[model samples]
Target chain A: MLSIVKRILGQMKNDKRSLGLLLFAPLLVLTLLFFILSDSSYVPKLAVYDMSEKFVAELENHATVSEETEKPEAADYLEDNEIDALIWSDSAGTHIELLEKNSKSAVALEAIQDTNKALQPTQKELIIDYVYESTGDNQLDSLSFVFLGVISFFFVFILSGMSFVRERFGQTLERMLMTPIRRIDVIGGYTLGYGLLAAVQSVVIILYAVYVLQLQVEGSVALCTLVMILMAFSAVSVGALVSIFANNELQLVQFIPVIIIPQIFFSGLIPIDTIPFGLGNLCYLTPIYYGCTALEMIMIQGKGVVEIWPWLAGSVVFIGVLFLANVTALKKYRRL
Target chain B: MKIEVCEVNKSFKQQQVLNQISLTIAGGRIFCLLGASGSGKTTLLRIMMGAIPADGGSVTVGGIAVPNRQLLAEMGYMPQNEALYEELSAWENLKFFAGLQRQSRKTFAADAEALLEIVDMAACKNKLIRDCSGGMKKRISLAVALIHKPKLLVLDEPTVGVDPVLRRKIWLYLRQLRNEGTTIVVTTHVMDEVTQCDDAALLRNGHIIARDTVKNLIAQTPDGNIEELFFIDNQSEAEAPLC
Candidate 1:
């Protein structure tokens, strides 16, 4: 038993990557999450074309509001702007026009109405209209919008990571090292093989989320599926790279809490912008964060690819780096 | 293709695995590397296969350095452990490996089927390796290694877990491969396995103690068996222990 323990520790001591993973993966995840989910108030942004001085003061107390001049051009300011809603005030009551309808916008509109209701003892009704024209018919699944992207990233990451670890433990990778197969080609082949399954999976998930669950996807079905596929591909690359550092399946599973779970918080499932200011930047570190953010932009917010190009570009870069890291990790087995 | 391992030295931190080992692997014959578990057989084979770097010295095959990927396609290497995916069927394993070896399925499908039949694994070609017994996995691994019809076959303890009958069949297949002008290098701890090889090298404690034909080796030992040589060496080493 002593010798057995010694041998296991001896093997682990030499494997610097596994040691680093054991010591730091969890710490990293916890640190990021602690900062992200820390106590902080989120202030919503609201703009008014023309409003009563009393109403503006009441709204400013609860949100970040701008008192713009009552120009006709300010109506167009509500289009694709950061202002959650346009609060129009007249003699009758307070009416709000929403540019987009999502959890964030919905919450913002509700807060505005609640604040306006308290302010006006005379006016009783709050009128809410949408620029994109929401029928207010369906009960939208808000979390699944981000969950759809996050889960796809999560599953693909695990599958690809486990498969690579299995290949190593079974000696299949060692056999490949013996053959004439170029290391990059091995990575490419795995990415494509898993990428194919991931692509199909993403489409099925999108269809299920959109048509079956009626999850309120507002983007092009085809483009949303393609973005999901790209996210899956990025996940595959990440999985391959991460699995290289793990020695076995159990060790690979250890990566889930560190790599997969934290991305849920960062992936906009809980509204990343609401997580306060400093921690919001850390979302860029996770690939799933880009995918989830992009999905939210395209699906719930009805933005096109051009709007989410930075997130898309960031995910592409993540995949590229992971692909290189995977190829380099194979160098431990065979120099070629 | 000829492999020349020149004064190869390897160490794992403090424990030396190979000690200035050198050997000339002649082409077109069956060569057996007989040694016990820790006698550096796998390490030496890995060096010859160009899968790992040597601490000192070098190995060259067909006049190129150990790890020339272009020349590696001509060599089929099967490590001590059976290197097949348990989740995949025998056919899938063969197809994936052959594809990685850059052989088109359309071109090598018949050859792969013939190789499977040779290993007597045709019946379970579609069954997952996880369901197969230990011996079946070894046989499937053998079939995969030969899928590309490599010119130089390097095997490390390829017959470790195989049954006697199947082992006999595999030896015959190796003999056939050697006769077809494929240079074969096989490592085994079993003394009897060396008798069938054209040439043999005995290693103990990371040193090649002897290298000769079966006839010459048997003639040199009193009991006319290589195991006698192994026992004599072990007995002497015990009487006068190394510092």
Candidate 2:
């Protein structure tokens, strides 16, 4: 056991790049998440022209509403980027016209809704015109969580698996085996090393998505971290276990589509109901299904630990079973 | 009192790699298992090292049966391939293997350095194995195998790709180990190396066709050299058994 620690430390000392990836990759990724989530603020500018003094006051309260003198000039004001929406009051009640520019229609629609509420009981109809989404409403934040889960699983799986497989093909595994070290020691060392690496990666990616990317993390960050760590554990174990079947590094990479893609399909990235019954149950069998589902529940739906524990539990079980399989597979060289 | 094998037979599916073969090697003796490729010489060595079990036979090392862990602990094995980690420096590789043997840090540090010196690779101990020459890698592998200073040493064609000068040096080291009560088992197809063995076993098609001292085998075959004796034995095997 002491030897395993020494060996792991020796290996880490020798491979600076892997060590760096293991220690700082999560921090780098988390920093990226911070920047992406926190940088954007929605403070849409608005201009009101020919509005009743009461309506103008309401608009000014909700947004940066400027009073314009002319209707024709209101269009000019919107084009000049002075406001995101325009309101013109006439005999047909207070007609709210939204400006179209390098602005989001959802933001414009939201502004219109707020204006209508502020002018309630006045019977003013809110007019919303979007340059885009004229056919149907589109969600900008849709599927961002799913995409995040996919990217996180991919990087964790490939990097972890490739590193483990290289140790085998490079004959480092055989050299280590020649020692009096137990089989469990090798498995434990790799699991702890890569497990720690994947945990940090998950934290970085999740934190970046929430705080940096500004993706709506409606649930607790602690729960998200828990799910990420579980998912990483599953991924690292699966990666290392699958590595045993691979004869070379290229063979290890070839497993990505087979091993990783199925998880994306089953992990709630796609609607499970849309899949055929036989195939839908296959998703239940994949670790990613549980991981992504838990992530989505926490990050998108704001669900807590009690709601997502089953999925988390399933992922933990998968990791444990795969770890055992990895240890068993190594018995081909030395039994017991 | 070193190694004993009785009627060992091994087969891979329909093909037999080791026929009924038996031999005993005394402690502190250099025994060379001589054979061409596919002669099952390596199989015999592997069985003795407890790397593989014989299909039908018993191998006893010291007094215990083959495949015993305790016996294996006392044996140093150098595979045909230089199985050192390519990414690690020679010193690091030695340190890892020595640690596996449960050797203390201070004890193995000096032993590893001494073995490196013996292999004439002390200067390049810190260099990664991938950056080393083929001969240097082989020498380093030998150093690692001997790091634990096992009582019995098994080398599988340790001098295959080595130059003559280095090969001679390796043989000298084997002899030195043998003189120090370390029973050495080596496999070779090089006929000249056969003469240096205290006893030689000529294996062909998994059968021990000849087992005796090199001088006795040469005397019986009317050839002063092992190369001639090898050819004579192969020619006789090609012909039918005389009535």
Candidate 3:
């Protein structure tokens, strides 16, 4: 088993491309996700004309209010894209003209509405609270936790799955079986070797997400990394087990839709409790669900290992079951 | 170490591969199993290696039962296909398999170099298996099987696609190993190569039609051509009479 680990790591050292993919693929995707999913603080620039100083001051809290001395200049500002919207009041009522028909325009309109509410002294202020104490970045922070679990699981699964399938195709598995090595050692060696790589991958991704991309984690980074490492091990074990049924690399790829994509759905894509028809219960069956849930607890909800041990325990159990399945699957090749 | 197979039966999906097959192979000799493709030669070899379970009966090597893990420590196998890590160099592949057999690093370097020299793969030791030619891969596979210096060596078609000169060299090396008390089992369709074996067995439709010393088996046919025995209408003429 130790020899197997040495050989696998040696092969990895030789193949620079796979090593690069293993370490950097998730980081690249996460960086892209950081850019795409992260919300930017977009403060709409509003051009107000014929508005009271007090009302304009209130609008400044919600938007960047710009005073317009000429009503005709409103068209110039809106056309030039310098202002998101133009607000003016007359004898009819207040009117707001939006520049572009996009999300920025909607933000400007929301700012205007907020300003109007502030002006109404008779209305009571509304206070909305979250059970988990969410800030403005909560949505992206929570989504990053899911991606942290899902993306690391995905790259490890495909790489390790393909590597094992190639081993079968090359007949090395058969050759290895002819030796005195036990079947369990083969699975264990592969897990330890590939699992080591996966652990490094998880650490790099988590560090890049937290320190570089500024992903806010309420709990200890070490604890979140532990969950991610467990998640990565599950991927390696499950990849090996699944490759047993695949005759070739293409056949292994076919399993992504069957085995991997469904896990993504259960990995916090849709709110588990909100999925119609009690399908949320299916999350327990997918390995990624436990990882994502545990990460959510640690990174978002600030829960410690004491509160999240069940999810961690669940991940360990899932990895153990799949590792045993991989060992049993070797029976098809060698009875011993 | 001697190998004994008795009444071994194996089938795949109701398709009978081996039926009540029995044989004995003495130690320190080269024993060849001769057959056409799909004649259960590979299956019988696999059964002997404990790679697949026999449906009935048993096989034993040196008093140890078949499929025994400890027994494998003393055995080496070279599959028909060149089963090698394509991404690794020939030397790395040798080290990996040698490591599995627990060959100590103190002597492995010399042993690996000598095996590579014997197989004429010393020049390509640093070349990756994928970059090597088909024949080079075969030679490396042979070297790997010989790396651990096992007591028993099983090779299936080890000479196919090899040049005649190298083939002669390999056969000479096998005889040398045999003389060194290594029990060798080989399966091949090469008629001339069978003459190099101390004993030979011919299988047709999962049954051994003849088993005898190469000299006696050749003399049984009308002419000296051993291939004639395979093409004979009634194979009973070539079968050795039971003691």
Candidate 4:
């Protein structure tokens, strides 16, 4: 029984990457979840209509507030937005329009009621206007925002890892090494071949998300697509490097958590700012972290490439390191 | 185009795979490394091809101490495993390997076609290797080994899964290549396969127990059979435990 177990483990030992992922993926994911769920405070954006300047100033101090005197514009703001509540003053009393299904809406309403209670005996009253009209949940935006990145990483990672695994299993990789071909030819050939495939995948996915899914991208579509392409290229390199340590196609798929899943946690949906010192900065080490960041910056934050250049450069550096690592790794199989 | 191994010693962890193994292979001749599994035949071949390094000593191909990049151009190696891409047709596999050496498909197209015909795989050259039989894969693997037209052909178990008919055809093809002045090194355990070579080294547990012509090896044995000679060599080693 001991020998049988040893034999099984010995087979696993040949695939060091799978073992590393088996140990490291859970630790990284736990770290991300601990930081993300720890913060519970909900801050609301308040839109006040025809309210007193004093009340607006006081409300601004407690929650994010925008004073709007225009009647139609204030009504539209109540109909569509991140607005937690809309405050208006009429002859009957003060009215508070609350965006329903928003947890912060209750918080916004309570702050106004508290202020009104403090001003008792001033012949004033407060009423709640619950807006049932859905402005479309921001939660979907948050989900889709990170979802684009996760999907891009998912497809490219699998394709590239399998491609390299096929090269090894077919023995064509060994044959290629036996030829007069240089190490650069082997690595560069794979990069060019799969890199083009990844580019096509990126183009289709990004275009479909933008045009078909109608996911709003604030920045230039060309630039957003460029970010995803760079992400795909880096993902391909990661797959190749990981492929060197995997023994089979099954071992290759085990890298999904180590390569793609962790990025979803550190993505903007989770508050990276609330994360503690050293662990927060550690998220920057993952290549997909940069991808998710750059995507969020373009699609949601309305930023150009100039603002996200540092993150994209980080991705290029990752690709360069993985390329060098893959070339050096071939030495283990052949002296040349 | 001469290949020589001198004092080649290799070890895997605590076990010695090859110890001071040496042989001289003449150009335009069929030489065989005759040994059973674990006798280090494959290790010795890999070292001479510069695919792996020996723990001690050196290998020279055409008077150039090997593990040299430029020298690799003249060396062709077919490993024990089937090395062709399953998804690709035989023609595509041949074209790719040939393109590695000459970098032009058109330049080596005729050479590849001729090699396929010699291996009796011309009719199925356009079929995907995934759909080919075990013998056909081995045949195309041989065709790929010769695709570059290297001066030295180092083949490890070239006829392992081949049928008897294809095996005979392979021996004839190896002889033809030998006549055309290509130095071929074939490794196998079957005693009859060694008879086709000009010179053969019978290895036992990382040592060359005997190196001689087929007739001389047979004449030296009391029973006068190649199989009996192999036992005589094995019994002597089995009696001396220190080796």
lDDT of 3 by residue, A123-223 (tens): 98788887776454635676777899999999999988998898888878888998999999999999999999999999999999889888888888999
Query: lDDT per residue, candidate 1, B116-217, as tens digits?
Result: 888889989988777899888888889888989899999888887888988898999999999999999999989889887988877788777777777787
Best by DockQ: 3
Instruction: Report fnat for all candidates as fractions from 0 to 1.
Output: 0.72, 0.23, 0.81, 0.55
Worst lDDT run of 10 residues, candidate 1 chain A, spans A1-10
Tell me the tens digit of each residue's lDDT in model 2 across A169-242: 65456555555567777787777776766777777766666675465666798787777788777777888888
Per-residue C-alpha lDDT of model 2 across residues B1-243, encoded as one tens digit per residue: 478887788998889998767788888898999989999988888777666677898888897886665665677778777887766889988887787777777788789888988888999999988799988988998888899998988888888777888778878888998888999888988988887789888888887777777778777665477766566733433221221
TM-score for all predictions? 0.75, 0.74, 0.86, 0.75
Q: Write the per-residue lDDT of candidate 1 for residues A179-282, one digit (tens) a residue.
A: 77778877777887677767777877777666754556677777788788889999999898889889888988998888888888887767667788678778
Clashing pairs in 4: none
* Higher-scoring candidate on TM-score, 1 or 3: 3
Which segments of candidate 2 are over 4 A away from where they belong? A1-9, A16-149, A159-175, A207-214, B218-223, B233-243
Q: Per DockQ, what order, best first?
A: 3, 1, 2, 4
Candidate 4 or 2, higher DockQ: 2
Error of 2 at A98 (Å): 27
Error of 1 at B6 (Å): 1.3
CA lDDT scores, all candidates in order: 0.77, 0.74, 0.90, 0.74
lDDT score, residue A247, model 2?
82
**Which tens-of-lDDT digit does each residue in B181-226 have in candidate 3?**
9999999998989988999999888888888888998998898888
Worst window of 10 by summed lDDT in candidate 3 chain A: A133-142
Give the residue spans of candidate 4 off by over 4 A. Answer: A1-138, B233-243
